[model samples]
Target: MKALISTGGQGPDFEKVKDIFTHVNLVVAADSGLNRLVEWGIEPDFLVGDGDSIDTENVATKKYSYNPAPRDKDFSDTELAIIKCLEKGADEIILIGGGEGRLDHTLSNVGMVKKYAQISLWMTSKEIITILSPGNFITHHLPQTQLSIFPLDDHSGPVKTRGLVWELEHIDLNQSMSLSNRCVDSEINWEITQGRFLLLATYE
Candidate 1:
């Protein structure tokens, strides 16, 4: 199933979430993420967090499953939510509403690419990041949207891209990045020969 994992923090507008809401099979909230979902009139299927930023009384009226952890746990709320999503047999996971306030937190959130292959996309209010495996990939966007794509690890294989202002063909992704390219076609495409790379598209 496609699980939509919402983590605490700001910058995940309703439009971004709504764009894929119909494709999502489940919604799991982490910590204050419940409040974000509630603001959008969305009731998540499960809630997991350290109970630091959430309101217990508000959750008591809900019927979804709740898994609370101690404030001193090793895992972050987003990690806990991911584990819960895995437990629910989610084959595909999309993370949204992650915090970019703290540099460390944002780094950890983006670094999740090294750990979870099930997570394919991250949609925030300002940016959209996608993980492309060894295959063909394509997505639509507004005209002239800026994009940057590269491998998190410096070991990705050759990649080819199309529909950008500056196109690429079979270039080593680790050695070169297609940075600051605008999607003039209102669509982007990529073909990966092997390994994984991240494609980041900024809305603002």
Candidate 2:
């Protein structure tokens, strides 16, 4: 089943998000993300975090509360939520509000998304972010929207992107480069040979 995790991030269309994610089988709140559920009058099935940023008692029950350590340096709240979902046999993950007002948190959340690379992870806000390995990827976009594929690590060889405005062929994309790519078509597809890449599909 698919899992939905809410994070305390800056999302302008928060009110409109619930409708987009109503198909999710289970809902989870990460730390202060519980406030987002409260704003919508919807209680999450589980709450995962350090329990410092949020009060566990405010939720429907403390039974599903997963309190880690305030000093634990292994995982972030978002990463913990992903592990919980994975343990419960989740095949896909959808994250909302992961790009909140804080730049550090937003960047950390993106890193967390990459850590859950074993599963099909998708982050949604005003835009959608996804990661793909060496495989055929397909996604739809609106007119003038941008789509960029950048290698997360140093490229071992070459990569190719098709159906985009500024297509790349066997290009070396490392962490030092590749960000804010613009989309040029209503549909996009790509193929890769070296390293895993992050796909940022935006509607701007």
Q: What's the TM-score of every candidate structure?
A: 0.88, 0.80
* Tens-digit lDDT track of model 1 for 28-111: 998888888877888898888877888766587788877679999888888988888899899899998775677877877877
> Looking at model 2, which ten-residue stretch has the lowest summed lDDT?
170-179
Give the backbone clash total of model 2.
5
lDDT of 2 at 119: 43
Q: What local lDDT does model 1 show for residue 42?
A: 85
Off by over 4 Å in 1: 170-172
Query: Judged by TM-score, which candidate is best?
Result: 1
lDDT of 2 at 120: 54
- Model 2 stretches with alpha carbons more than 4 Å out: 55-73, 124-126, 154-157
- For 1-204, candidate 2 gives per-residue lDDT tens digits of 888888777543655466756777888888878777767777788888886677545654544555554757588888888888888888888777765377888778767766676445455555666667776666677767766665665553466666666677644576444556666777777766766776776645
Error of 1 at 172 (Å): 4.4
